[model samples]
Target: MFNKWQAQRWWSENYDRIKELYNVQRLNRNAFALPTPPISEDEASS
Candidate 1:
């Protein structure tokens, strides 16, 4: 079984690599997402 110390050590070693991957994934998602058009005030009242 893995101990807490070992788990923490593993995360510490790989944190930056994992974080970089996560950031790339987020950027790709944002790049592909379409922007929503603003609704008119009149539409909100209906």
Candidate 2:
């Protein structure tokens, strides 16, 4: 369930609020923040 206008309003009010509430300011400050990619087994072993 997603409404385009509602989404816009949420972000328009203040983009920073999203980051502050999620507590990921240190990890990511982008307006469109995404989770870190998963590491493969080989990459993790190295």
Candidate 3:
């Protein structure tokens, strides 16, 4: 698990890329069966 500071830093550094990947994953998941778990349930609604 990440400490609070490390988590914050990682989010700041990777949020945009993470969002892009999450969207791609969501699209692919909808199109077919995907084994990967979701990034977050909150993201799925947006």
Using TM-score as the measure, which candidate wins?
Answer: 3
| Candidate 2 structure lDDT | 0.80
What is each predicted model's overall lDDT from 0 to 1? 0.84, 0.80, 0.82
**Model 1 stretches with alpha carbons more than 4 Å out:** 24-46
Scored by Cα lDDT, where does model 1 land? 0.84
Cα TM-score per model: 0.45, 0.32, 0.46
lDDT of 1 by residue, 1-46 (tens): 6699999999999988998987744356578788998999999889
The residue-level lDDT of candidate 1 at 16 comes to 85
Misplaced by over 4 Å in model 2 are 26-46
lDDT per residue for candidate 3 within 1-46, as digits (tens), equals 9999999999999988998987744355466775697679789788
Better of 2 and 3 by TM-score: 3
Better of 1 and 2 by lDDT: 1
lDDT of 2 by residue, 15-42 (tens): 8887788876554457568779999999
